[model samples]
Target: MQAVRGVLAVFVLALVGIVSGGKMISDFPKLSVQQMCELMPADTSFLRPHTCNYWVRCPANNTSLEEGTCAAGLNYNKDLGRCTMAANVDCPYSKDSISTTDNLCANETDGTFLADNSSNDCKGYILCKARRENKSNCPNNLIFNPTTRSCVYTNQYRCPVNGAKTKSPACLSLPNNTRLANDEHCEKYYICVDDILYERECSDQSAYDVVLGRCVSALNATCYSTAKLPPPENTFCTSMGKPKVGYFADDESCSHYYICGDTVNGKHDTNPQHLQCGQGLYFDYEKLSCRERLNVRCTLDRCADTSLTYVNVLGDCQAYARCSGGATVGSGRCPADYYFDERSQGCTPVNHNYVACAA
Candidate 1:
């Protein structure tokens, strides 16, 4: 009994030493592992929340359990179900489940995470600013990707931002039969139909409409410009496997263009410099510069045939569409003084300033 009392006295000294050090006992990170490891049922192995190096296994009928730490330079990946190199696994967080939503920020430092609410788990997220909760919802066509920490296309990320909300309350409350712009590549977009995501790419390099959520010319649509366009190899400025230095126009949008080389040194930059012209100016790809938007023309399937050079705009005499290599590039409308001679063509006065002819 005296030996036991001596051991207890040592423990009390250690406790006093820790308490006197000025940090609360609860402030130690291992306290969570200690508390949760003991509470888990025997014979179960589990990961400690928010940590990548520590894992705990409950021993049979034992009150105490020891946490196992991963070897040096390795992190635990729950998806791989094992510990591996940090490169092999993406350790966004060690555990998929978060604390109860009532206090989503509980035990969480100053950071943001998915709200993943039970009743409406589609697009909500909670931001932890100054350790205070600021809950907000993503737009109707988007869903929160906890991994990316951004609101993405509804079809790109299946709803239920976190795993806790998945299949728990039947399913997510995401919008059905909706269109969403791909946040990465301007050429790609998505459609969510009946809770399933369908990925799509534009036939041409058209940008997805930000507001209407449909394919529109880059000149017209506000494509999500987050640097995910086709690489330089596939872009218009690429030649002999290297990007050339110049201003390159987007295929569809008259207003948007990109600068492909260094401005200061004339050396080529790694990525094409995406840019936009003023509101009314369109990028003239052939002239390799921006010009006033005047005669760009378009109609349903008017420029489908590559063999045709000019197609008259139906019903409109002033507007015509210019097709080159089977795609409409600009408007072929005659100048105000010179009307399109239908013996020449009747232009619809749409999306074009003809590069082939003077304005």
Candidate 2:
């Protein structure tokens, strides 16, 4: 029917998140929306993979899809096609290579490599194993093939997004521990435990006070800045600085949570009033209400530039942190009889994979 629907065109990259004459871009142009609309085949829109601020149009012939947002503070810049602002919006879902703190496979003298088509995309491909750095792709939608290395079929491969040096996660579909604010590296921040989305930083490195979401003193962090904006429309409480009244959580859904009252003058209702959690139940930020669904696990958070991994410290048991690729670096304490132990990285009295920091 339209060539078997073109499978949503796979990942139609034209390349351009804005940078026109200065021309430095370095590949930047992603557009996955991964898999939504289930199967549209209508007027065709598709630009919601990782996120620019939400979208999924599709009308003309209509197969549904609808769901769009991009205005307050703005973002959605599919290369000037719309919304734009927040420096010019780069975010297409982050990670287009550039991680190297040494060890992206040392020098690779042993098996399946792939990233050098300037850097990435041929559907990813890193492997390695012992030295670490997994980063693989090309499963079915196929695209690897660095001269018969593997994966096939494609109008020359797709996936490539770097949202200005990574920092787009406020932990989608929030409601776990939920604490966020890394508008784009104001020293780093983001938690959501149980819902996932780790990526923290700023123990003394300072700067990330998006109105008390934590970390301070980069001259008092007005929201520091390494420049490269556009990853903040946070909207769960707008980065939640003045929020206090009662329950809060739900940036997209965890069955739902959010409710504030009073403080009409000091300003702290970053869009309040949200509820829902009783049909099979869900919301449970420390038993604030609703339950079940394995006691509410939710889900969201990502890391992969090579991702080493290890997290827990949002509420603290003794402490734990370490994530290498995608950043979080250093953090671990556990002394009194030992604690933090993911097998071997230090701190251990036995208790490995983390059970909410053991606290």
Candidate 3:
């Protein structure tokens, strides 16, 4: 009887072990909160613990198995496990947790971005188009400096005016019909019109009268030099007493006649007299009077030596007078069209026909 009972006990223990193993396998926990939190389902709506776990409670609300639980906490919905907020509502995922797209930019178009896909959203993630920061869009005749991020105009052609090939940022017209060239620098061709100075483009020389100071056809236009000369024919003459006779003077003698010192009229006369001429004048023995020598005071007719001319293009007179025929005038010659032919040494017009006398 003792052997039979021991054997029966062993058989009973083996059967109990089999039953316990089967039960443990069937009653195993379906899911844990830690596992549910980490699982990312294909459909966010299926993220509830009821769907994912066989035995665990809801992970989001910590509810029992009977009450559905959301995995996304307060952001979660019973039907949709994913977190979402109503339009214009503040949300944790947003920059300001708001349903607006204001803080984000959209990625579209070169060098451009969009803040929102739909106009309804005031704020969202912005998308931006990627571009090289160093790229530029400068055209010819314009240089772009990356460091400055500015386009600079250049004068590579060395033109006198309007030479810049690039279009001007601002169009500027010449004031008072001013002349200009095709160079970068606007060269001015100025003329006196109706007593008023006017400027024009240098290339439009034909459209202006340089002499009349008016706008006229450039064809056959008279080009004038800035030079001027004083009037002609005003003079003074004084005779140095007939060749000093014997280089002495006598009170009783009508005119003291000295030894022949100089020749006059091919005669060995004892009179050693010399003739004295005033400024702008030379003695004319035939007339026995001083006459104007145009070449004497006129810069145009004066000697070719540039230093002798009284005035230059800039209208400045030389500091000293010009010497001619071994005689020195007290003052320099007047500019072209002006004359100082008289003993007064004042400047006057060369001819009323060509130029009006200046006051």
Candidate 4:
């Protein structure tokens, strides 16, 4: 009975031990090597499992955990299901996990890391980034004005008028004394002269008036005379109104006038000059001359006597005559001892006493 009781007690104790071991295992959680390393203190012994290898380490420790090692197990925590350490441990908060937007070395309050946001290192870095991005913050010194953009070493510059690269000493020291020219770098400066830009010179007299202090043409009256005078006879003289008779002046030299002449017979002469007919009127070639036209007679008479019995003597009325009484006359009648003649009714023989002539 004593032996059996001892056996039963032993069984109970073994079962209790097994139950406690299982409960302990159940309370603990698995942890990765990284988690276990993070849990180690800055100053602590890192021991190997079952080999008795131990080493003192600090937060600076960069060692990796051996697989299936007790050192890993020693750092594990069942309650939190992770690892913990007392000192020299790299805490989760100390790890660098900044976003892409943030500067690696920038403090939270300030956005830059150099003096006045300028540093050779920073500049080099920015330039590298710019090159990588295939861009430029400033190109040709003209596209970007550095002064306005808060960059160093750049200002506005313009080309000079005369295209000179260097200015005279007077230009540099005095106001408005500079030349109207540019420097090799195409930079221009204002010249000083009486508080204004000094651009005039002695050689520019033709282009500028020293007395008037203004620009003017060089070909003024002072530099040239009026057109050459015309000849005396050809000139327009008020005294010679009628172009001097035989010597007629050209259209440009003559002045217009009028002349009066005689009227011949009942008609005024239509010619410019009244020359006689019997003297034979002819054109005078020596000077401009004129003459009158001769008078001519008509074949028919315009006036006739209607009371007399007669026929028109002339076919075109060039002349007229009266008819006699008691003649062989009808509507247009003739008088006695006169016959009605178709050509003329002047008294004639009854039988062939008169003959008509071809007028």
lDDT of candidates 1 onward, in order: 0.50, 0.47, 0.29, 0.26
Is candidate 1 or 4 superior in lDDT?
1
TM-scores of all models? 0.25, 0.18, 0.13, 0.11
Kindly give the stretch of ten consecutive residues in candidate 4 with the minimal lDDT sum: 181-190
Estimate the lDDT of model 2.
Answer: 0.47
> What lDDT score is found at residue 235 in candidate 2?
41
What is the C-alpha lDDT profile of model 3 across 53-142, one tens digit per residue? 111222333333332433332333223324344342222233442232122222234433222222111211122334211111233344
Question: By TM-score, who's the top model here?
Answer: 1
lDDT of 3 at 335: 62
Better of 1 and 2 by TM-score: 1
Cα lDDT tens digits for candidate 4, 80-136: 323445232322212231121122233323222121121111111111121111111
Worst 10 contiguous positions by lDDT, candidate 2: 21-30
- Model 3 bad stretches (over 4 Å): 1-267, 295-359
Error of 3 at 332 (Å): 14
- Candidate 1: worst-modelled 10 consecutive residues by lDDT: 166-175
Candidate 1 yields a Cα-based lDDT of 0.50
1-359: candidate 1 lDDT, tens digit per residue = 77446544543343333222212111223235444333222444554545666666556554556667789998765434467897786543424432321345655777555454532556655555455444444554566677876566666577643554222111011124444455446666655443334457775546666445667766666655341455333345566755587776666655677787643354345567788776545566777666654433322334552355665555555666777875678875567754453233453335333432333
- lDDT winner between candidates 2 and 4: 2
Candidate 4 regions exceeding 4 Å error are: 1-86, 90-151, 154-359
